[model samples]
Target: MGTEHRTDEHRTDEHRPDVDRALKADCASCFGLCCVALPFAASADFAINKDAGKPCRNLRTDFRCGIHTGLRDSGFPGCTVYDCFGAGQHVSQTTFGGTDWRRAPDTAQQMFAVFPVVRQLHELLWYLTEALKLRPARSLHSEVRGLLERTERLTGLAPDELEKLDVAAHRRDVNALLLRTSELVRAEARRGGKDRRNRRGADLIGARLRGADLRGADLRGAYLIAADLGGADLRLADLIGADLRDTNLSGADLTGCIFLTQPQLNAAKGDSATRLPPELIRPAHWS
Candidate 1:
């Protein structure tokens, strides 16, 4: 994938689309591939050790987690974040025609292999769908849309094709769109030329603060959990001890956020979409 690109142009005010088009649990359209196809060690994030291709002991015969309603309480928080990006449903219904992994035991391994591939394609879809909503990236929306369509089509390919999926190339294409998105959002971050600060314990939850300038601010001990910080500017801000649990930092600029250590974030929560600086491990709690 390509590296970062900087540009000057404000387009954050354009009407972005709602991203809920992506799939959720819709068990009727999926085979619970994630629970069986992925491996997890016995840890705080999972209740038991399960190897790749092995279904969790708690997985019901009907393809639902036996502990679905209590995954967090049962030490399987990671299961809560295992979104298939609609690929699980696509594979279960469209590509494989609603085949059950159990009934067709012969295709089990193939299904396992294709699950991750479809997942990558679907994750890219999430990003492209999000990029399309960026008004600032309007100049590149056509290209972004093209990539989204192509990536979406790949998710419906045969198991053989999906097994050989070129996810890296698709990621490169999505990164191109994101570069444009960053340029558009970052331009808005430089507005007003007035550095703003928020005090501790401020109620910033669920605030639509995309692309806002927040450099050099004191957000220490702030209650910013679950805040919509996508595309927000956090260059050189003091994030020490800040409560970032569930804060959406996707595509947001944090090139030089001060005191933003990995442990602090590991103590919080985030997803695969979050773009953290190097040397940071994804917070284990995010799952």
Candidate 2:
């Protein structure tokens, strides 16, 4: 999916030296599960309408995207921003013993059903991994570790078990832990600051926040679509689930920002001057 071309440097978080390499997408080792299992609508992001369990029109016989090098130019920009969090490879290899859907038609439906479930679990793994790295959240580290291990075990469940998993409930439990971790980290970050406003779930769509002092701001789940956040100081801000599509991040400092994923950056507008977290790579389309 989105992380197909990521290099070793981009796949890791240096803060967590023992970060799981399998948490990053390895498209070469995958069965192109994202291309076949997920549905997409015709919009600014995708060029055609696709249904779940149907392979994308551009998917090749060998389970690779035909327009891999020119997906954006070919009007499949949506594919470029999709991160399966390494679920594709895990399902293709571990879940199915490296048997692709094409070879074992009988398993195709179950494979597709299990992919999304495992994907959600992997996303939780990513966040929990980062949570353990936050020094300010040290007191909660043991709890985070326990959940991380539990989530990892969930990903390894049989396809049948994975299909029947109550992923939403599991996500709720994990999110509660992450929320506590964010509070601890942000409190440490804003210890001496007065701008401790809690903007959790705020609707800031297209708002002009240029050069704003958002350091340590609680922006969890904020709708920032097309917002002009250029030159803002977002250090240590909690950005989990924030809609960043076309949001201008030019020259903004996002160093140490909590829960910011690569797909979020890929969907936004940024530039050379934007200070990103060490684990994330700058999108190529940024000016």
Q: What is the lDDT, from 0 to 100, of the residue 164 in candidate 2?
A: 92
Estimate, for each residue in 110-139, the C-alpha lDDT of model 2 and write its tens digit. Answer: 999999999999999999999877877878
* Best model per TM-score: 2
- Once fitted onto the true fold, the runs of candidate 2 whose alpha carbons sit more than 4 angstroms away are 1-19
Give per-model TM-scores: 0.65, 0.94
Clashes, model 2: 0
Write down the RMSD of all candidates, one decimal each.
11.0, 4.2
Model 1 Cα shift for residue 139 (angstroms) = 1.0
Give per-residue lDDT, candidate 1, residue 109. 94
lDDT, model 2: 0.88
